[model samples]
Target: MRIDGRARALIAADDRGLLYGDGLFETLRVRAGVCPLWDRHVARLRVGCRRLRLPPPAAGALERDRDALIAGAADAVLRITWTRGSGMRGYAPPLAATPRCVLALAPAPAIPVHWYARGIRVRFCDVRLARQPRLAGIKHLNRLEQVLARAEWRDAAIAEGLMLDTGGHVIGATAANVFAVIDDMLVTPRLDQAGVAGVGRAVLLDAFPKTRVRALRRTDLERASEVLLVSAVRGALPVRRLDARRLPVGPWAR
Candidate 1:
């Protein structure tokens, strides 16, 4: 089903997000008619707007739109998109942009509880993420890299792909952040250079005071006692395999 609201049918074909992928988006999970991470999602959305030099939308209006879209859904994946709005045929942004926002809600995928219990198998993707410090932590619309990495395998056994940055650092998975356990410390890759700073990663770090955020290399990943993938939509997912190497379940695998 399509998104419903007053703004739903107002998306223009010439919108920058559709035309040039010049926008930011957030995917949130709705449970029991409430979004647990709504504040964090709004914080990230504001940060993304600041980074992209786009105007922020009104929070109350956004909430109203979101509520309207997911009114009856018990569980849903809500995608909120914001663009620089319409403009003339040019590469430069408009002088006074009003900005366009769209909130769409749909049923979430049926993820088996066993997937988390048994852990997931992942492979090292050939796709290398470019180091764009300016756009490193923001969830922008440019995702060709992820698309290519996901296309590397069609096997259902391989749940996801771990991606490395151009500097040979383990940035993150195709759609989630990577966290490893080393000497009883939770170490995650620093997003100053690349990778999306996921909401789930932030939640874990906030919940666990001992969690350490640092730059991780390829060798660091190979030596990790435990590796897990995390995102806002999907919580923590343990990685069982990377390429031909098998990772044993450790204390943090849960």
Candidate 2:
């Protein structure tokens, strides 16, 4: 782990990321020592920094740290986290706070190959995401809601759980983005109200010209011909069952 461009494993106890969840994090897939989706991660990080009023580190600095951590790794998960530097007590941030950047590399877990071929089953989470447009679409460090939602299930057969916004609109799953195919067109929930706008979702939207971004209801998902769960690390997995409904693993998923 590299903290603020230095090689270290310890961070200050008063660090804003620890004291208060004032930070942002990006998780990218490192393949053969190279991150294919680096640009997208950086782009999303910048958006988070801008929204959170945190200064972003130099692009070159981040790349250097990432390269150093991923040295010679074949396949790994690289995480870059930034927090408002240590400060005094209370929620009001210091005026001239320096940002802290931490980067780490971990071995990528082996995913079930059959999940991609045969599809995976998912469940609807009881936890509803609170609508916060200011924090929406960014991979921020404040993920207690997700933590709670993930704990709602203990079934190993369920690959992911779908979540809805406080207003009852389908947002996404615990970690990945959700998409449904209807009438030969792709539809994904809009992040303007809630949910993280993921890099894989952006890739899919660009790849499929018929993609549409808007509010999605549970009925919309039930009526769709196919459902897909996408993320930078997972790539794409077809959803064969959502709740008690069985969805088709269509050709588009392949």
Candidate 3:
């Protein structure tokens, strides 16, 4: 692990990221010593930095760190966490805050090999996401909502849980974005109010530019013929069942 462009393991205890979640992160899948979606990830990170009012990393700082860590490496998951460095005991940020970027590379998660071919089951989470348009669509450090939603179930048969915002709008899954095929039309939820706009969802939208982006409800998901849960780690997985509703793995998911 490297922090602030150096090979280090620890950060200050008073760091704003640790105290108040004042940071953003990007999780990229690395293959053959390269990130497949580096450009998209950087683009999203730039947007996140702009929204969070934090200084972007130094020129080529991330690239240099990534190169040093993934040298001659095989498949892995590289997470880059950028945080507002240590500050006094308060919510207001320091004027000359020095941001810290920590890069950690780990073995790629072992996904069920058959999940792609055979869909996975999911349930609706009881925890409702707080609607915060200012923080929507960015990969921020605060993830308690997702954490609580994930803890809702522990059944091995259930792969994930769909999360809804306070207004009953389908935000996304605990970790991924949701896509539905309603009336033979591809549709996804709008992230203006809540949820992260994942890169996998962006890939699908680029592939199918006609896919509608709108406010979706549980009823819309129920009416859909097929649904897909997409994420950066797991590209796209078909949803075999939503709670008790049986869904088919159609050509879209295949």
Candidate 4:
């Protein structure tokens, strides 16, 4: 792990990130010592910093850290966390809070190859996401909602859990973005209300023409011809069964 461009493993106890969840993070998929989506990750991190009123990390500095951490590994998972450094005892942030950055590298998990070929089963989570437009679409540090949603299911057969917002609109899965084919049109739920806009989802939106970003309800997913759960680490995984609705592993997902 590297903290502020230095090798370190500890962070200040009074850090605003620990106290108030005032931070942002990015998880990138590394392949052969290269991050194919580094640009998109950095772009999203900058946007998140702006939304959270935190200074964004310098691109050059970030690149150096990433390179150092990867260290010519064949493949890895990189996680970058930016926090609003330690502050005095109060909710108000320091006038010039120097942001703290921690970059870590880990070996990629050995996901079952079959998961990519055959669709994965998912279930609807009982925990509903709270609507927070200001924090929506940003991969912020406050993920207790996701933790709770994930804990709702313990069956290993279920690969993921689909979450709905308080308004009963489908936001996506616990750790990925949702895409579905509706009447021959590619549709994904808009993240202006809640959920993270992952790098993989961005790639898909840019690659596919006429992909619609709109409010999606449970019924919309139920009626879709195909459904895919996309993430930076896992790419795209087809949703075979979502709450008893058995979907097909469409060709597009493959």
Report the Cα lDDT for residue 128, model 2: 96
In candidate 3 the C-alpha lDDT for residue 61 amounts to 86
Candidate 1 residue pairs in backbone clash: none
| Candidate 3 lDDT, 72-155, residue by residue in tens | 779899999999888999999999888989999999988998899989999999999999999999999999999999998889
Count: clashes, candidate 4? 0
Which ranges in model 3 have alpha carbons more than 4 Å from their true place? none
Instruction: Evaluate all candidate structures by whole-model CA lDDT and list the values in order.
Output: 0.86, 0.92, 0.94, 0.93
For model 2, the run of ten residues with the poorest summed lDDT: 55-64
The count of backbone overlaps in candidate 1 is 0
Q: Write the per-residue lDDT of candidate 4 for residues 119-223, one digit (tens) a residue.
A: 899998999999999999999999999999999977999999999999999999999999999998889999999999999999999998689999999999999
TM-score of each: 0.95, 0.98, 0.98, 0.98
Query: RMSD in angstroms, candidate 2?
Result: 0.9
Residue 132 in candidate 4 has what lDDT?
Answer: 96
Who is ahead in lDDT, 3 or 4? 3
Pairs in clash, predicted candidate 4: none
